[model samples]
Target: MTKERIEKILKAGANVVLTTKGIDDMALKYFVEAGAIAVRRVRKEDMRHIAKATGATMVSTFADMEGEETYDSSFLGH
Candidate 1:
């Protein structure tokens, strides 16, 4: 897997990221290093509820998270 894509996935500001398919060992290590929690095998329906409850927008790709380096605050639910 490309580190660039992995970096993008890792950089999402959410406190926790839920994925239908589990992440790999490398990703797990990166997540630990970044202090982010990644929950795998999340039910699609549950993911919907989580986004709604946490006021987070569900994004399919990390490319949309722009202008993060200029700001320190995490818009993602904490």
Candidate 2:
């Protein structure tokens, strides 16, 4: 998603779950600053290293999430 859209979601009180291939320091900082949670997918062999480096939880899933609006705002700040 675009930064603007992500910001709008954050403003709307939705908790974010960023799923990306790699985790960069800048991306980590941006997500934290925006009050969102992020998870990075990495090779099983490198999962431990990546998780240690970026502080992002790793998960295994192959589902397609395009155009799916699954974020809910009710669970935030409680």
Candidate 3:
């Protein structure tokens, strides 16, 4: 995933589910700085916990998810 995609998920009020091998702390930190509640490193087995913690559903996809979603600018601490 790209920085834009990470921001998109945060804007949607959803936590990001990053693959273990692909867990980028810097990216996750950026999301949190952008007002994300949390970023979770997930394995297939950890999906349940991720869902429970974030209260957001999970999706499995191979397509590149690297874009920004709309969000309220006011929520960005501006």
lDDT of each: 0.64, 0.54, 0.54
**Winning candidate number (lDDT):** 1
**TM, every model:** 0.67, 0.36, 0.49
Residue pairs in clash, model 3? none
Looking at candidate 1, the ten consecutive residues that score lowest on lDDT are 67-76
Cα lDDT tens digits, model 2, 9-70, are 56656454544476666666667887687566645656556555655444334222775443
Model 3 shows how many backbone clashes?
0
TM-score of 3: 0.49
Residues forming the 10-long window of minimal summed lDDT in candidate 3: 69-78
After TM-score superposition, the amount by which residue 28's alpha carbon in candidate 1 deviates from its true location, in angstroms, is 0.9
Which is the winner by TM-score between candidate 2 and candidate 3? 3
Clashing pairs in 2: none
Cα lDDT of model 3 by residue, 23-73, tens digit:
467876776787554445556668657555655444544244465344432
